[model samples]
Target: MHPTVSGSGRLMLGFQYFLHFSVMGIVLPYFNLYCFHIGLTGFEIGAVSALRSAALVLFSLVWSILADRYSARKPIYILCIFISTGIWSLYLFTVDFWMILAITLIYGIFYSPVISFLEAFTMDALGVEKTRYGSIRVWGSVSFIAVVILIGKIIDLYRIDVILVLVLLGASLQSMASFKIPEVKRSRKHQAFLFPITLFRKEVIVFLGCAFLMLASHGAYYGFFSIHLESLGYTKTFIGFTWALASLSEIGVMIRSRTLFKNYSLHTVLVFSFMMAALRWGCLIFFRSAFTILLSQCLHSITYGAFHMSSILYMDALTPDDAKTVGQAANNAVTYGLGLMTGFFMAGALYEPIGAKGLFAISGIIALLAGAIFQTMGKRIKVFPP
Candidate 1:
């Protein structure tokens, strides 16, 4: 039977997005900053970020394989949610670099698959009305904006360590909500024992390569943007506002996803997003004024919001029905996992030598390069035939 999602199922899925991203709002802006405050060097923080991404590369695939093989996506999804939450609590017990690094790896093993699994579920749940994905996915951006704005002020009022408690609480609640996720029954016809070779099609490969570079270009921003802000003498509240602003723009694009995709090809949106990322990072390289910074932040509507939705939809279009979970897992692994891993390590290694401004310059170049290569090759090679 074709998969079907009920109203309550969609509600639970939206709740999952909110809770998961709310925790992300905490970690993305503050976790590395917390490390910095506690005396971890730039390299150490980068290592932590890269290692977690590495876990995503390896483990997301493993979990997806099992889920596809056993048809137990719900059970596996719930298991990872709870286990990762439990592991994250270990952060409260130690601040030592090595110990924290170890914890990050273990936590990442469980945490890595959660988002990919969630994406697969969302895609499956959306079913025939998948174009409305933006409506459901907007919940994540909503929670993210709210948390970053709220936590920024709270951090100004209290200790940075408070982030740990808030993240734990958010995750704990997410774990509880995981129980509400309705099981999605995939068609047995999609059941397969081997990875579909179509996954290696020239178009898919080219697309993934371009996507990899696009995300890799974000390494400096995601890994060090908060630190960059603080180094510029911006307050925690200001940093929070800046991050929240990005998500706010992201929500605008996401809210318009259905219309955007209907009017433009996924290929066009991806290319535009890549070009905008280059421009956005270039702005960061030269400007430090609040107005300029905020202006550039708005480009996130294209850079991340449009790029991400396009990438997901593109991969869905390319993959075989049997390998839906695996396709999203691969997308997450290549872009967010390996791509971010490379970016984090590069940023970490260079942060001390070149600083955040220098890192932004390099990131801009990487993004431009990705755009050029994809633009030229996509058309010449007929990667996305109309």
Candidate 2:
């Protein structure tokens, strides 16, 4: 493993995450609300979201391959940020469904690689002591909470259109932050270690499949949680607080993730996360009170925080150094891209017929299935030790 990165370098990396996810926390939680404000229906919103996921799936592999092949990540990382900033600005001028769809696709091309490449760069910077990844990544959760709460209040006082400005500002700052990450030098020795076909082994496939199901089950929450609250007569400020609560819980989990990794196998953590996800969604189906919803949101710690951190560590342990980027990309492609695409599409279809409660109940079932799949892996899968 390469020497542990200098303390300043680690801080810069953490700052980059803080900036990037700050943009995401603003955009991801509220984009559907923006669509609603603009007169788009649930189905129309779903179609737009699915297009974005499609772009992620289509381009994530291409970008990750390019990054891995050239042994370069920083340039692509910076390019993606600048380009996303430009594309997001176009939102100010367009509102037609088709036009919005086209822009989302274009945006996806540049945006898809952001997280996957960053994960690869971060893991590389941290080397074999990968547990420290959570320490740095938790900064993202902190920033996300700040952005969501602040923006929610702004939107409450002003209008949803202001989100475009916030998104643009976040993207601009993210581009600047990207410059602080030092370039990762690629060695010729590692260049030949491309993504291997053997990665499709049954255990790995099961892992990816379970990850996909877990993420897919989150479709209702990600795509429509804000709108659902709004329809229930909750204020935008309250909605934002609920979203911030999830990130707050996520922050607690990430802060302790290294210790969690120290005591449990990645497989064990994943199973626990999936189970918690199931319970969280189930609670969302039956509960509408503020207290219950806030309590349910706390499970975000297990559902996304622990699950995501565990998945990264698992991929790092399972993949060769040279193929790490590709591994991370594949994880993004399957779970975030394909899984999210499926979830949003289905939620759109089922939402009108079944309503939010039914949608969440279905999500609970899918989470249970995901946990079942992971259970089947059992001792066949290798566990990462402290």
Candidate 3:
């Protein structure tokens, strides 16, 4: 309905989403399998996986701060993509566990910046009619499903090493897309040492903490869920399809997030998202039935898709334009980088003793705790650019 938001803007956002998620599909469904194929143990894989998040903890804040200061988003996004794709491609040559971990560590530092900036850029492109964001982001979910299914078929036929080839191709395409995206210049000029942490209000801190807890809960799933499925006698292809099904559901939810957000507050969405995530993981722990798992996976819409969209919108609505990119980045730093690193490490160390059942149960509990925390922060937390 808004003039600033256009079909063209949606198209550009969708294209960007496609590249970002396609890269993810290639990595998520296959990376752990590749690690196993090369001789890493479950513990080692968990450690290596955590290394990526650990690196993000170190660098995500710095990158987000840069985007806040610079205002030119596209160039920094491109640099991160090129770095991510380049280092992750190292899998083709290395079988050493430490080497793989090293690659993951380096890749995450650069890769973490893209999504944070891209969210800010896309919102700028959309302006008042941000309703279109979900429609555009759903394309990413759809592309992810397509790639996961395609790569699953390939893994069914060929050796797991073939995954690296797909990953390389995906990253290359993403980098090219990043290059083609036109830059959006922000109007607000920020001070050079505008450290947001110094000015972060209680609400922002609470929101960031809740987001961190939610992502931390996903640590087991993102780092090792694929491997867990395989360990449970599920084939790589079946595991891939599970991921695909979840994405399909996510796409559906994404298309409706605009309407959903219109009716609900951002805090309400976040609380609901974490509650659903708790349910999703809790259900996963109890039912190994394929249909049950499939249904639970579908709830990923509420769990991840809704959670992510709401977080960004909340950040957008609450923060100043000058601090928008930094806010997103700070959330990522704490959530993906720090929280994920912590989750993966805990999940890794605890995996063998607890098994998949116990691991997912913990994830569920954490989600519930996050939801409770968010509820407590309600109406009391400060909302702002400071």
lDDT of candidate 1 over 59-145, digit per residue (tens): 998898888877878888899989998999999999899999999999989988888889889888888777778888889999999
Candidate 2 Cα RMSD (Å): 1.7
Residue 86 Cα positional deviation in candidate 2, in Å, after optimal superposition: 0.6
Q: Between 1 and 3, whose lDDT is larger? A: 1
Candidate 2, residues 226-331, lDDT tens digits: the string is 8889888999889989988998998877888779988998888999999999999999888889999999999998899999999998877777767777889888
The TM-scores, one per candidate, come to: 0.96, 0.97, 0.94
Candidate 1 residue pairs that clash: none
Clashing residue pairs, backbone N/CA/C < 3 A, model 2:
none
TM-score of model 1 vs. true structure? 0.96
Distance from true location, Cα of 316 in model 1, Å: 0.6
Q: Give the lowest summed-lDDT range of ten residues in model 2.
A: 189-198
TM-score of 2: 0.97
Better of 2 and 3 by TM-score: 2
**Residue 221 of model 2, lDDT score:** 86
Ranking by TM-score: 2, 1, 3
Q: Which regions of candidate 3 deviate over 4 angstroms?
A: 1-6, 197-199, 382-386
